[model samples]
Target: MTIGELAKRSGLTQSRIRFYERIGLLTTVERRANGYRVYPPEALVILRVIAIAQSAGFSLDEIRTLLPDDRAHWDHDALTDTLRRKVADIDALALRLAQRRAQLVTLIDEIEARPDDIDCADNARRVLASLFDGD
Candidate 1:
């Protein structure tokens, strides 16, 4: 297939495909006599892996390190370790997000309980000042 075909097949732009190649995220493709890129259909498999890895929160460098240099060189142990570390990182992030959600819920409750007959603007100013230690 050609670059255009690859782009359409991968749902990426031609420039993005070239950039991925330039940045070493993708292997350099062979060009034909007409100076147009000639991509193998298998390249789509690699591109799909790269896209899914990125969306899964893996960095470009991490993905590069995680993917096998070649299919024949695949290592199951290394893949397991990397995935384990990613799982730990995701767990930590989830815990922090839950804490943030709890704090937000408390703040909302406080706001909801604000005195209705009080001067709301002045009360808000005082609340903001106390919250942030402002003037």
Candidate 2:
């Protein structure tokens, strides 16, 4: 498959795919005689893994370290440590999300509780308070 076909199939931009290849985050891809990039079906799987890892807050540089080599072997201790670190990261994100949700809920409650004739000038203050008052 060509670069365009890989981008379409993997839901990534062609530039991003090429960027990964350039940075060695992706393995070497076969090039056509015409100099166009060609990808195998497995490349899509790797791309999806890259996307998920990124969403989980792993930087491309870090991901490169986690990437398996062509030999398909990894150090068990290192892999365990990486999983532990990722779990810690996810826990911190969950805490932040919970705090954000509480703040949003307070904002919604305040909006719902506002008096029918409340001064328009105070509405903005109420919202600001809801956001920063995180209790």
Candidate 3:
């Protein structure tokens, strides 16, 4: 298929497909006699895989490493290990985000718990003391 057809089928813009080819991510392209690009049917699948991997948080470099030059020659163990590591990284990020969220909630509660008798400056000092000295 031509670059336009590939772009239509892959739901990617022509420039993006060309960019991928230039970046060595899409390497199955051939040039016609008139200098037009021709792509095999496998290009569509590869593009879909690239989009999926990207959505899954795999960077282009990581996807390049994970994708085998020959589809039949994928290293199963390496793929599994990499996926597991990504999952672990995501888990660690989730833990940190949850901790941060909890801290924000605590801070909100502290800020809202100001006494009516205190001025804003004194309440600010009280909050700071609780945050620093109480910790």
Candidate 4:
């Protein structure tokens, strides 16, 4: 198939296909007599895999490392290790986000618990002090 056909079938723009080729991510390309690019059917599969990997948080560099020129060969251990590392990173991020959410909830509660007699300025000072003192 031609570049246009590959782009249409892959659901990617022509420029994006060309960019992938230039970046060495899509290597199964051949030039015809008129200088037009021809792509094999496997190009569609590779493009789909690239899109799925990207959506799974794998960077272009990471994807490149995972996808070799020879489709039959894949580093299973490296792929497993990288996936585990990404999961761990996601877990750490979730913990941090939960902590931040709890802190924000605490701050909101503190602000809402201000005394009726105290002015806003004094309440602000009290809240600031309580936060700093870890109260």
Clashes found in each candidate (C-alpha, N, C closer than 3 A):
0, 0, 0, 0
* Poorest lDDT segment (10 consecutive residues) of candidate 1: 126-135
For every candidate, C-alpha RMSD to the true structure in Å: 3.2, 4.0, 1.5, 2.2
Considering only N, C-alpha and C atoms within 3 Å, which residue pairs clash in candidate 2? Answer: none
Evaluate residue 131 in candidate 2 and report its C-alpha lDDT on the 0 to 100 scale: 63
lDDT of 4 by residue, 1-135 (tens): 998899889899999999999999999999989999999998999999899888878899988987877877877898788878878887988999999999999999999999999998999999999989984
What lDDT tens digits, residue by residue, belong to model 1 across residues 32-134? 8989889887788889988988898999899888777675576989988998999999999999999999978866775666777768787776667666763
Badly placed stretches (over 4 Å) of model 1 are 121-135
Task: Write model 2 residue lDDT over 47-82, tens digit each, in one string.
Answer: 997898898898888787777776267677876788
- Alpha-carbon deviation at 66 in model 1, angstroms: 1.6
TM-score of candidate 2 versus the correct structure, residues matched by position: 0.67
TM-score to native of every candidate shown? 0.82, 0.67, 0.90, 0.82
Q: Flag clash pairs in model 3.
A: none
**After superposition, candidate 4 runs with Cα above 4 Å error:** none
For model 2, the run of ten residues with the poorest summed lDDT: 67-76
**Candidate 3: segments with Cα more than 4 A from true spot:** none
Question: Which residue pairs clash in candidate 1?
Answer: none
- Candidate 1 similarity to native, TM-score: 0.82
For model 3, how does the per-residue alpha-carbon lDDT over 44-133 read when each residue is reduced to its tens digit? 988998998899899999999888887768899998898899899889999999999999999899989999999989999999999998
What's the lDDT for residue 24 in model 1?
Answer: 76
The numbered model that scores best in lDDT is 3
